[model samples]
Target: MTDLRVGIGSLKLKNPVMTASGTAGYGAELAEFFDPSLLGALVMKGISLEPWQGNPPPRITETPCGMINSIGLQNVGLEMFLREKLPFARQWDVPVIANILGTSADEYVRLAAELDGAGVEGIELNVSCPNIKKGGISFGRDMAVFARLVGAVRKTVKSAALIVKLTPDAPVAEFARAAEESGADAVSLINSIPAMAIDVNTRRPLVKNVIGGLSGPAVKPIAVRMVYQASRAVRVPVIGMGGITEGRDAVEFMLAGAHAVAVGTAIFSDPMAPLKILDGIRAYMENHGIKRVSAITGSVRT
Candidate 1:
């Protein structure tokens, strides 16, 4: 059997397939479709100190190969997450990662403290949320702000692993370096680029939010390049996601130096995509006479 296990900092995953934040909701929501335990890990939606109602009107729009979203990070706050979501997730067999966001450093610190004892395997800091008009770009655009925010949260969370999610809009190498220097255990990259669509009839913005994060196939190449750049900049492991639809797509990310891969838009297309891709990866590894998934990470040559 192929050894699919890989490490994200000190945390080891059974395989390199994880559900991206927002797409999988909390772990419990996907349980109805398939066995949650079969997944390598499940990343929850971006949670805040308080519940958010999210943006107004149309939040998601379908594009040619992908989709644009302005969900606005709508989620139950940390308190309710701990009281309700985390407890339910604890019953699942796979590792659970909480994707968190806050308007300020203190809020991030406070949320981290609350989830520190919530039995999650790790915490993914949502530093790249472009939906919120106020603080969405605050932490992601500036290296100093990113470092300070991560540093504060690092001090607060004692147990859970910390993974900083980065935006593709910034200088990926510099931003990733800042995250590592500030005490991030690992980093996930390419959290959708800012994009907009026009309504031909109305001659107005397609989405009510005016701007949305573009994801899916259109963003895959960008995600791959950013992941490659980030992997070279930091020693911390990198988790990659963009428009992965099949096993080969996942392999491309792995070869680009992503320690693991997350499936975002593909999940909407195929609810069983993760399992299928996981199986395909194993078959490919065995066919190539490879024994472990680590053998492919950063193995791409010029």
Candidate 2:
């Protein structure tokens, strides 16, 4: 009975629950397990200007409460995504946010221009992927570069909402402020931390890439802090993600000033995690006599 609808700039979500990028490969793959309409939005995999083969084998490895991946923004190029994936995905009822990456500011601008006409709801600018050795995380590490990159993309995408996704490794408040100044409508945070694991018996790194991005329960606390700081730093909306597994976890992020929360690594553990979390949030609101989800946003105790 609680109103769960939330907004990210000009885009409105039915609820604050959305499938994170990379985890939900385009909405088509998860259609059988859950209805895409139930989600706030579906962010496609990180698409580039050209197709990428991604890193070599052993891209993913399991940790105690989290997982690491070096997927390297593997996906069909922007043209292919528009021609092959976007048409079909448009049939779904929920908003579709295209997640895109590029090697330079020009590439980001070009990709954003292309996606603006793709009939999707918005674009999530990927500035914090740790898998790629070059442009991914590097763009987010420096506030100046981050601002310039976002400003370039902002000039290109005339219609769609631009959401800049920031890295948790950086000073989130500073980065978020830069994103806002650069004309971002909203910002999502805490992609993943760079990490590596070793196989004791083989006495070698477990992953083929030797290093990867860590996601899941282990990163939740860091994410919350980043979101909280970011919320204060920017006047724009914030979408928080990192190791969110349950409705309570989602609530925590919202309390930390996230307008909406995204579920990433948790989907692998439970296929219906987002839906269940949505239900749990509604139930929590009802039990606590709270009339809406927005009322609880940023209400956490310091």
Candidate 3:
């Protein structure tokens, strides 16, 4: 029998396929497509210390083989998530990981502490967000700032597994290592890369925010490479994302050194993408004569 179970620190998942944050809004949004329990975990939309209205309209724009968005981490505050989303999430057999974003150490600590006791299986710290307290620079872009942020979050979060979601602006190896060293249970990498698009006809920006994060097939190679670097740099498990649309993509990540993978923009096109990826992974394992999914990690050759 094939074994698909995987782990990130003490957090054990039935399989390695999880929905990326923002793509899977609290799980309920995708219920029509597949049972939430079928997934290893669900990373809901980014939740902040307080509610966010998100950026202005034209937030999403299509690019060749990908898309760009500056959704501005829009989400209900932690309180609403607990009052509304948590109850529904508790019914799912799969682990629920809250993706929390903050602009400062105080906000990070507060959100982490709240989610730690909110019955979530894990907390994914989105350190890539703009820090309002620091002139809007991303915390993950600087090693020193990243380390201090993680250290603060680590001190506040007690029981929930800490998974640091890294930004692509910095060296993933160093950033991931810093997270692991600062008490992260695991690290996920290759958050959307900074990009922009324009309307030549209208002479306006394609997305409302002028600049947005690029995601989809165009980012796959970079994400895979970063996953390899981060995995090699740290002892903790590495969760890879970016431009994953099918099972083959997931397999590529696993072979590149990712212990687990997340599906994001692909979800917008096919709600069943995660399920299909799961099946594809199993088929790939069988074809390779590998019984356990873990065997695929770091199996890539130069």
Candidate 4:
């Protein structure tokens, strides 16, 4: 029999496929396509203490092999999430990981503590959000600030598994190490890269924000590289994401040192992408004569 389980600290998932936070839209959104319980885990969209209206329209724009979005992390505030969103997710048997974002350390700590107390299986800190108290520098860019915030959340979070989703702007190895040292149970990497597109006809930026994060097939190679770097740097599991569109893409990530992979952009084009990718992983394992999916992690040739 094939074994597909993967563990991140004390949290052991039935498989390794997860929905990228922002794209999954609070977990319940995917229930229409399939049972969310079938997934290894459901990582819901980014959540904030107060409602984030997100950026203005023209938020999403397409590029050659991907799209750019300055969606501005729009989400329903914490109040509604606990009142409505989480109860629906609890109906499913799969692990639910809350992706929390904040403008300062206090907000993150409060969110993490609340989610942990709520009995969610996991808490992922989306450090890509800027530190409003520090002149808007993204928490992931500055190691000192980043580690301090992660540590504070760790102290506040007592039960749920903690993960740090890293930004692509810095050296992933150093950042991953810092998260692991500060008590992260796992680390997810390759948050969208900063990119922009221009319209020659109107001379307007393709995305309303002027600059948006690029994601999809175009970022796969970079995601792979960073996944390998981070995995090699830490003992904790690494969840890789970027441009994963198929099962083969997930295999590429697993071989590159990712213990798990998340599907994001493809979800926009195909709501069933996550299950398809998960199926692809099983096929690859059988073809390779591999019975344990965990063996695929960090098996890349140096």
How high is each candidate's TM-score?
A: 0.96, 0.96, 0.99, 0.99
**Model 2, position 212: C-alpha lDDT score:** 90
Better of 1 and 4 by TM-score: 4
Worst 10 residues of 3 by lDDT: 127-136
Q: Judge candidate 1 against the unseen true structure and give its global Cα lDDT, from 0 to 1.
A: 0.88
Off by over 4 Å in 3: none
Task: Give the clash count for each candidate.
Answer: 0, 1, 1, 1
RMSD of 1: 1.7
Tens-digit lDDT track for model 4 on 1-302?
78999998778899999999999887767898899988999998889999999999899998999999999999998989999999989889999999999999999999999999999999999999989999999999999999999999999998899999999999999999999999999999889999999999999999989999999999999999999889999999999999999999999999999998999999999999999999999999999999999999999888
The order by descending lDDT is 4, 3, 1, 2
Q: In candidate 2, what are the lDDT values of residues 2-77, reduced to their tens digit?
A: 8998988889899998889999888777887988989999988889999989999888999988998988788988
Considering summed lDDT, which 10 consecutive residues are worst modelled in model 2? 128-137
Clashing pairs in 4: 216-243
Candidate 1 structure quality by residue, lDDT tens digits, 97-182: 99988877788888888787766789999886432435456588877778988999999888888999998878999999999999
Say which candidate scores most in lDDT: 4
Whole-model lDDT per candidate = 0.88, 0.87, 0.92, 0.94
Clashing residue pairs for model 3: 216-243
Off by over 4 Å in 4: none
